[model samples]
Target: MARRLFLHVGTPKSGTTFLQSVWWANRDALLEQGLLLPGRGVNHHYWASCVVRGGRQVDTIPAAGLAAWDELLAEVSAHPGDALISHELFSPAPDERAEAALRRLEAVADEVHVVLTARDLVRQIPAEWQQRTKHGRSQTYDAFLDMIQKDEQARFWRVQDVPGVLRRWGQGIPPERVHLVVLPPPGGPRTFLWDRLCELTGIDGTGMAERATRSNESLGLVEVETLRRLAGTLQDDGMPKSTQRLLKDFVAEQVLRTAEPEKIVVPARAYPWVVERAQQMVAELDGQGYDVLGDLAGLVPGSEPIPGRDAADVTDAEVADAAVAALARFVRHEELQRRRGRRRPPESSLRSRVRHGLARRWTALRARAGRS
Candidate 1:
């Protein structure tokens, strides 16, 4: 049996979650079919990749996880058939770490391959902005636009990031070994991303059954403003880190049920250099025969260029719904705040609050002492 491994590195919001879900649900079946999807504690294969990519970013791969990685590789080496590991976070790693990890992977398996699914730039930018906002960012599309324009140094929106992403995982791997999956045209084909993976892996996607995928979408300036205003006013909507994550999946499923795309404006303050840089990158990649992931070559200029969308139709009803959502968020935030209040304040928090109160009381006490 050949020891081959397929690694799917995700560019977050590009359906990584769906693929993860697919592997998890079918783990037993896959193992029976002579395939492997490791789950020592959880099914976050990217954790191993992250460790392989070097640990500084998302908690130094815990010691247990580090040992687990070794065990995982051993399994891969001994397993009779093939295996799969995926985590899109791998897409952003610096080349050295990515290659270092791939090298480790290659040592364990006879063949190591890379897969990345991409959407167009026109949609990705705003989608990312919305993703940030959902997690408690208050940056307006306008401000985000400003950053995109002037923050050319920031790698998130740059075309440079795309090639950088590829160069990392593609190390010691042939171009053909790197498979690029373009999201099929909307409403065109079913499970296009999954089906493509099926084709790439020579597995039957249909047997796995199709389910909804998680995606990030950007809100329009107005819609974003609405959420921001609501966040400011609502005490509950604070979205503390812990609860926010758990809620995010639920919100993504229920609240954000598929909506239409929203239009956006890309002013000079937003992505000023993106147009030119992306075009340059596209040309550069095309010349190099590199398949530019997503629609970077097609990214538009100007504030009017709509970014990727999360949902659409911001009707009065939707706005009202969002308002209710804001209240729900506020309530959660307040609940957390109250819970925090009840806690023995971290000695630091207690001292700080008491010091300010004492300062105010001292003035009043001094006045009374003077009067006496």
Candidate 2:
């Protein structure tokens, strides 16, 4: 068993994707420094997802996926050194589920530490809504806020409920062993989170800035509203869920992602409620006495809100521009495919030339024999 295990469970949208990307990109360097980062690259999310969404049979999960938990433990155990595992999905796990996951890790770890990265709800709320939209949700930003208010068990509350996430994952672990990484507010030093992560994991954070190959890009107000409008049209046509997903992927990858758009932020009207909720969560975490790696003040909501039009107020004219962009992308993709088709085939093989030579020789020989 490893001497220590650091589990970076998450409060999603707290720069988890960027962190994961960096870890994966520098995996080789980390291994050289004696830390085992198991699984495919920097993400062992499928394994963590299987554990959190526990059930006898969940078709969405890959077959034999549950074995990933054991496999991860085995990797850590085989290495007589410290190891790290990360997955943001593990944050929203219910108490019982979180306990089970913890016990499993504890069985193979001499010491276990739970790491939770958090951000203020003011930022998290709109980010969560945008994430839901990216996943094919058709709700407008205003309707999404209403759903959060009305539904106690809504997904927004499930993962973003900071105190609840900490409680479930931090259950029996020593308060000091639980590390709360407070993400610096937007516009703070970009390297702040990376530096703190290195401090917590005892790994080098340098030479890794160039290795981040994955990033979760946020959609702009117009881009998202346009997609939502497209979704509505699909719904009216009774488009299948599978088709809707493909359409969303196409627009997101082919159209929306071509250029970084101005990000959507929590509206001015919603700012006060968001601040209050964040303060409540901050108070809860403060009482727990966890080892906070960054400034607790980072958890406080920022004062300035970035300007964005509400999704519900998006006009057809605004969507038309996005539609034109999507059409251009389609044309470009088609031209690329045509160019690929027009490329010449490679030269014929030596064996084919030999066969042709032999055939010609045989034909000449037969003709000569007949003449003789």
Tens-place lDDT per residue, model 1, 10-34, is 6666667777777777778768777
Please report the candidate that would top lDDT against the real structure: 2
TM-score of each: 0.69, 0.85
lDDT tens per residue, model 2, 1-372: 888899988888998889889888888889898788877654355565656657642454556665677778889888878888988887767789899888888888899999988887777887887776766567888888877867879878778887788788888999999998887767889798899988888887787967898887777777777666555544544544455445445556565654767667788877777777777777877767899988887777877666776666765555665656655665686588678896644533432332233234335444554665
Residues forming the 10-long window of minimal summed lDDT in candidate 1: 349-358
At residue 134, candidate 1 shows an lDDT of 57
Segments of candidate 1 deviating more than 4 angstroms: 40-43, 53-68, 155-160, 211-240, 243-247, 250-278, 287-321, 325-372
TM-score of 1: 0.69
lDDT for model 2 comes to: 0.73
